[model samples]
Each structure stands twice: as structure tokens, then as C-alpha cells.
Target: MDIDFIRGARLDDHLTIKTYISEFKKASLTFAQEIVDQEGVTIAKALVKVACIDNVKMKPRPFLRLS
Candidate 1:
């Protein structure tokens, strides 16, 4: 999994954050998040990508089956 922050936010300012799944699968998920200040100004954005591996030796892979 990897998380990247695209903007900087102050530590003392009140923040509102929201996250939503952009894509989802049995073995993986992708999401985006946004952070805003109290004034409703966007202060930061993040994209998170995650992959599932069954074992340590197994390479990362995507979802193969859906239920």
C-alpha cells in the first residue's frame, strides 16, 4: 500500500477530512481523500492504493473473483 499527501496542512488548524473509495475489489482498494480547513478551503489531498497478497512470497495481485 502507498499513501501520498499532495498538500501541507497546519497542525493547529481545525480540519475536516473525507474519504471515498474510487475503486474496490476482492483483493484491492483504491481511495481518495480530501482535507479542508474550517473555512472550507481545501488544504490537502491524498490518494491511497492498496493490494492484497496471500503470502509474503506471493507477488501483489488484483482481485480474481467476485462474490
Candidate 2:
């Protein structure tokens, strides 16, 4: 929305665009496994995707909103 953010988003988007979907999917699953182990609960795959997307957008644990 702001200049700095716009520039950052452009940078991040450029970098993100280079990522292979399969790799992202693999990493997301691996990360979700760690979260499941730490939380001691099985999380739905959709949640894992959401969490992964949120994280790539920016780390979510620090300011996680369930909705």
C-alpha cells in the first residue's frame, strides 16, 4: 500500500515467483509436520496451506489470526 511495502512486495513477489510449486508444497508439508509435532495435534492440510501462505506473506506465529 505504501512505497516501501510496494517495493518490498515486488521484491518478495519476484523471489516467490521463482519458487517451484512442488517445492513449496513439500516445504509446507514438512513445516506443518513440525507444527503438528510441537502442537501435538494433527492439522488439516488446508490449514497447513493457509499457514504456509501466511508465512510466505510474512511470519504468522508472531501475529497469527485464526480467521
Candidate 3:
């Protein structure tokens, strides 16, 4: 999984966080998220990607087919 932040967020400020799943598959998922202040200003943004992997084989995990 990888995460990147575009800006800094402060703890003292009231913030609203929203997230969306941009892509989804059996083996991986991609998401986009943002943090905004009460004034509707964007405080931070992030992109996340999660992938399924097999630790023992050190390779990507295969997706199961549904009937």
C-alpha cells in the first residue's frame, strides 16, 4: 500500500474528512481522500492504493472467481 499527502493538517482545527474509492478490483483497491476545514478550505489530500500479496510466495495474490 502507498499513501501520499499533499498538504499539512492541524490538530487544533475542526476538520472534515472525506474518502472515495476510485477503483476496486479483486487484488487491489485505489482510494482518494481529502481533509477540509470548517470554512470549506482544503487542508490536506491523500491518495491510497492497496494491493493483495502473498507473504510466503512474495508475489501478488490471485483473486477468487465467483460462481
- Best candidate, TM-score: 3
The lDDT of each candidate is: 0.78, 0.28, 0.79
Instruction: Name every residue pair that clashes in candidate 1.
Output: none
Q: lDDT by residue for model 1 over 1-67, one digit each (tens)?
A: 4455655677788888899998888778888888888888887777787788868679766567748
Q: Which residue pairs collide, candidate 2?
A: none
- Writing each residue's lDDT as its tens digit, candidate 3 over 18-52 gives 99998888788888888788888887777788888
Q: Rank the candidates by TM-score, best first.
A: 3, 1, 2
Error of 2 at 66 (Å): 31
Candidate 2 matches the true fold with a TM-score of 0.14
Q: What is the C-alpha RMSD of each candidate to the true structure, in Å?
A: 3.6, 18.2, 3.1
Candidate 2, residues 1-67: lDDT per residue as tens digits? 1111222222223222111122243224322221122224422221124234453666544323368
As for TM-score, the candidate ahead, 1 or 3, is 3
Error of 2 at 59 (Å): 27
